[model samples]
Target: MTELVRMTGIEKRFPGVHALKQAQFDLKRGEVHALMGENGAGKSTLMKILSGIYRPDDGTVEIDGQPIELSGPKAAQAHGIGIIHQELSLMNDLTVGQNILIGKEPRRSFGRLDERELNRQAGELLGSMHMKLDPKTIVAELTIARQQMIEIAKALSNRSRILIMDEPTAALTDAEVSELFAIIGRLKSEGVGIIYISHKMDELKRIADRVTVMRDGEYVVTVEAADTPVSTIISMMVGRALKEETVTIPDLDTAETALSVRGLNRGRVIRDVSFEVRHGEILGFAGLMGAGRTEVARAIFGADPKDSGEVFVHGKPVSIGTPKDAVRAGIGYLSEDRKHFGLALGMDVRANIAMASLGQFTDMAGRLDEKAMQATANDYIERLAIRTPDDRQEVQLLSGGNQQKVVIAKWLLRDCDILIFDEPTRGIDVGAKGEIYRLLAALAADGKAIIVISSELPEILRVSHRIAVMCEGRLTGILPGGAGTTQEEIMHLATLRDAMTEEHA
Candidate 1:
């Protein structure tokens, strides 16, 4: 294989932060090299330098064995480099063909836009990549997975030989992931080098040829994927050994029922859902995508309207027609898409922490007590082990894991007893995941009723005292959470609909 990209002595700095320190990375043609790290490990910072999004304060970038200084994104693209960010960057209002050839659209005589040629070229590119999308379809009407494919199409349209994919499978289904891997295979055969960045350790085995680990903005080590253990890679990334242990179910027979839901229904999305979480207990929700796990949580939290249901807090029925009402009834919901639904990204950590319970920090004259808010925010910041310079730091500057902790702090400051966490560790790194798991356990031990909804079966087993499985908007079964419960059992309950369909046939 030929060397495609190399960066040596890469260094970058921002105000009050050293984003990268003497970092180094290299890629070879026809290889998939993975970059693994914790949320704040500077993976994005390094990649930004490679993709011309940011210029390193000190470093040398070489493309195709030739040293080059990339002035901007266009310069990098001119050198056959393309990056697809974690957040899709397509214009939703445009057609797929228009987005794919945005600035490079073909023109006819008299300098008129050649719409037909544009669609034809886009169709050819999608077909070559084995995508089944029509070029004329509106971008906003496609699913996340399909939109991801379009991003790839757009990258390939630039004649890119070096491709960088960041968290590409985060929003994809199993079938979609298989499709993506197939495309990667095709690209590799064509001698295209790929830099894959993802937090899902399992993917390294399936797709990556080599794995590179970075920690706290510095290069650690790189090794062949086939010769390294996942544990070794994790240790290199987090600087410590992580204990993989199952949950120890506590005896909650005498515990008070903190939250109860009965006959919950919302159109066909949620059908007759019912569950209970006792004080000092963690109840896990497990199911396939679209299995109504999130829907049930939203209805219970009053984020979505439930056609028919009764919510009981402390064994007493409560009316929760709105999010404010649910909060008043001692319920706090952490949404799965935390960036959009959970936090004010531009606000400081102190303001975001006090956002949920502003009234508590306000005096009779309607003036906020800034000192009190700062004191409370700082306390939670320390208690939660949030890695931030101070409470006044912008939440957007923090990593994904720390931002999630801030959301948790907001709810805790509100003093909600019944907490519902939806995909609490989604998009978070493994090291941070352990911290979140510990936090959930401590909260449960402190007698806070908790409901955790997760797509990953192992996470559900690790955090829950009891597991509730759903299928096609209905509760299939509930099982004990521990070593006694296997992933197979959870899968069976999750695919109950398929089993029933076969039986009926």
Candidate 2:
């Protein structure tokens, strides 16, 4: 293999934060090198420096045996380095081809925009990648997986020799991930070096040639993916060995039912969904991407109106037409897209934590009780192991896991008896994942009926007392959740829709 890229003695610092310290990284042509680390471990920062988004105070970068200095992203692109950022950077209103060829659009004889040539170039790029997408289609009209493919295509269209992919499959389903892996293999064969950054151990094992682990803004070690164990890599990332956690089988059969949804019908997405979560029990909703788990949760939480359903709390039917009614009925919902639906990002931690249940922290004169809110926020910050500098810090400044903890704090402060967590650990690191699992277990132990909707089968198995499998918006089966529950069994239940309907018919 050819030596393609290298960074040695990299150092970067921000206001009150040393983001990277002497971080070392290197990549060979045709190799997929994965960067592993916990949240805030400088993985993204190192990549940013490589992509010319940030200039390291002290560092040396070399490409193809030649030392180089990049002024900005365009300069980096000129040097054959391209990065697909974790967040989608596509212009929603623009056409797919227009966005892809935005700056490099071919011009006509009189300098008029040559739309045909531009679309042709973009179309050729997508076709080379074996992606069948309409160049004239609006970027916003595409699915997340397709948009991600566009991002990758845009990066490669720059004629890059090295590509940096950050959590590329974070929002993709299993089949989409497989397609991406195949694309990655093709890129590798084309001699394009890739720097893959992800927290998923399974993905690392499957797609990575070598794994580079970082800890606390410093380089830890690099090992062949086949030679390194997941446990060893995780230990290196967190600077501690992670114990294998098991879901405790709680005695929920005799426990009182806290929340029950009967005949939940929501426009073919959630059809005849019925389930009961017992007091002090953790019920896991497992399924594929569009399996209706989140729909059921939204319907129960009144975030989405159900076509027809009966919701009961404590064995009594209730009317919940809005989020306010759901919260008042002792139900709290934490959405999967926490930034948009579950939090006030611009607000302080204390304010966001108290946002859902501010009525309790209000005086007789309708003024918020600042002291009480702060105290409650501080308490939960400690309880949930939220890594925040202080309660006064903006929620946006916190990591994904900490922000999720703030959302959980809000519902707990409201004293909600039933809590529904949708994709609770999405985009969180492994160490923080353990913390969240522990918090959920503790919440259930405290008698809060918990419903966890997750796409990750391992998470569902680790956290739930009973797993409810959904297929095409219908409840297919309910299985015991534990180490004994295999992923194959869960997948079988996830696709048992036609058979289930025929059996019922």
Candidate 3:
């Protein structure tokens, strides 16, 4: 194999933060290299430098054995580099073909837009990738999985030889992941060097050829993916051995019900859902994609309208028509899409933490008590172990794990007794996940009722006292969480459908 990319002694520094230090990496043509790291470990920063989004303060970069100074994204692209960010960057209103060939559209005479030529090229690219998508379809009309395919198509349309994919499978289903892996196989055969960044350990075995671990802005080691254990790679990334433990089911037999929902329905998305979380207990919701677990949470939180249901908090029926009403009734919801729904990314940590409960900090003069708000924010920041320069730092500047902690702090500051967390640790690293688990346990021990919705069976088992499984908008069954229950049983329940529905199908 020929050397495709090499970087040595890479260094980058942001205001009050050293993002990368003496980092080193190498990639060979026709291979998939996995970059493993915790949140804030400088993985994104290093890649940003490679993609020309950031200039390295110190480093040497060689592409195809030729040293080059990348001035911008165009420079990197000219050098056969392309990056698909973790966040989707497509224009929602644009058609698929228009987005794929946005800047490089084939033009007609007089430099006019050639719509037919553009669609033809994009359709060819999509066809090459075996993506069954209409080039004329609006991007917003597609599912996240399909839109992800468009991102890949757009990258490949640049004729990039070195491709960088960040968390590509985060929103994909099992079948969609299989399709993506097949595409990666095709790209490898064509001699494209792929830099794959993902937190899902299971994926490395399927797609990665070499695994490079980075910790605290420095390269730890690069090992052959086939020869290295998943545990070894995780240990290198987090600096410790992570032990898998099952949740210890607490005795909630006599505990009072903190949140209760009965006969919840939402037009085929949620059907006759019923559950309860007791004080001092954690109840986990388990389901596959589109299984209505999130819909149930949103309905219970009053973020979505429920056609027929009853919600009771502490044995008192509450009318929750909106999120504000739910909050007033002692319920807090942490949405899965935290960036869009949970936090104000542009605001400082102090403001976001205090946003939900500003009335508590208001003075007699109808002005916010800045001192009180700062004191409370700092206290929660310290308590939650959020790694930021200070509480005054913008939440957008913080890493994914820290941003999640900020959301948790906001809910904690609100002092909501019945809390619902949807995909609490979705994109966070292993080390941060441990911290979140401990925090949730502590909250439960402190008698705060918690409902955790997760797609990972292991996560549901690791955190819940009891697991509720949903299938096709219906509550299939509930099982005990711990060693007594296995992933197989949960899968059976998760795929279980009503007899009538199955018969109709």
Candidate 4:
């Protein structure tokens, strides 16, 4: 293996923070190098510098033993460097071929796009990766996995010698992840250097050749993946030893039903879903993406209208047609896409937290009680351990984990008995995820009926009192709270989404 990329003495600074401090990174051809760290640890910042999105205040980047300056994104692309961001960056209305070959399309002599050639080339690229999809297919028509495959194809199309993937498997299913690993194996065999940035420790052990740990904007150490234990990696990344333990609460077997849905139906998204959540239970909805887990939650919370379903609270039938109706019925929903749906990003933390319960603070004359709202928001900020300078700070400025806490705080302040959390830990860091888990555990112990929908099997297993698996809009199976339920069981249900057998029917 030869050094394909070397970045030394990288230093970046903001107004009050050293975003990166003398950080160093190295990548070798034909190897998968993993960068591990918590959120705000400056992993992304360092990679941005590599991709020419940012110029380091101080550093030297050497490629093939020659120092090179990356002035911009185009320069990086010309140098055979490419990055696939954590969020998919595709135009939904465009065709797959257009997205893959954007900016560098094949053109005819007249300078017009040669559509046939473009499609043929894109199809070949997909075929090479063992992906079965039409290049002419609209991006919106593809699954998340297929879209990710298109992203990879786009990178390869750019003749990327050094590829950077940030949380590439975050939204993928087990089968999709396996396919991605196969593609990675092929890339490695072809001597393509890959920089994998992920919080998933297990993935590093499975795929990476070496692991580079970063903490608080500084490189801590680098070690062979096979020789280093996950515990060692975690300690290096966080600058402290962190415990990996599951927190369990006592069984709430005899608790009253907080929310019950009978025959919940929402077109093709949710079908004949029926479940009951008891008070003090963290009932987890486990399945792959597009499994209707989030759809079920939306229907139950009245974020979307269901075709037919009966919702009950304390055995009393309730009519919930909208979010207001759900709230009136003592239900609150935290959408998975918190930035877009759950929170008003531009609003201050105090405003977001008090948004749901504003009416409670209004007097008989319709006068707003600013003092009461501030006090309430301040209380939740302290209790949730939200890392914000002040409640007056905008939610957008806070980290992903803190923003999620604000959403949770809003619902908690509203006194909602049935809480629906959809991918509550998505985009959250490892350390922050643990804190959120602990908070959820405490909430369940306090007798809140919690329905947690998560794509991460480990998170679902660690947090839930019981696990319910959904496949293609149907509830396939429900398992007990304890260690009997495994990731394999959930995956089995996730993949069995085509159709139910006659016996099952």
Best-matching candidate per TM-score: 3
Error of 3 at 247 (Å): 0.7
How do all models score by TM-score?
A: 0.91, 0.90, 0.93, 0.90
TM-score computed on alpha carbons, candidate 3 = 0.93
lDDT of 3 at 292: 88
The 0-to-1 C-alpha lDDT of every candidate, in the order given, reads 0.90, 0.88, 0.90, 0.86
lDDT tens per residue, model 3, 1-505: 9999999999998777888999999999999999999999998888889999999999999999988898999999999999988778999999999999989999999999999999999999988877788899999878666788899889989989999998888777677788889989989999999999998899989999999999989999999999999999999999989987557788889999998888899999899888788999998998788888888988888888999999999999999999999999989999878998999988999999999999999988899999999999999988999998888899987888999999999999999999999889887888898999999999999999999988777888899888888899998887888776899988888888861122100
Candidate 2: clashing pairs of residues? none
lDDT of 1 by residue, 1-505 (tens): 8999999999998766788999999999999999999999999889989999999999899998889998899999988999988767899999999999999999999999999999999999988877888999999877556887888789888878999998888766677788889989988999999999998899999999999999999999999999999999999999999998666788899999999998899998788877788999999998877788888998988888999999999999999888999999999999987887899999999999999999999999999999999999999999999999889889987888999999999999998999999989877899999999999999999999999998777889899998888899988888888776899988888888631221100
Is 2 or 3 the stronger prediction by lDDT? 3
| Model 4 quality (TM-score) | 0.90
What root-mean-square deviation over C-alphas does model 1 reach? 3.4
For model 3, give the 10-residue run with minimal summed lDDT: 496-505
Q: Give a tens-digit lDDT track for model 2, residues 114-154.
A: 98998899999988777788899999877656787888788
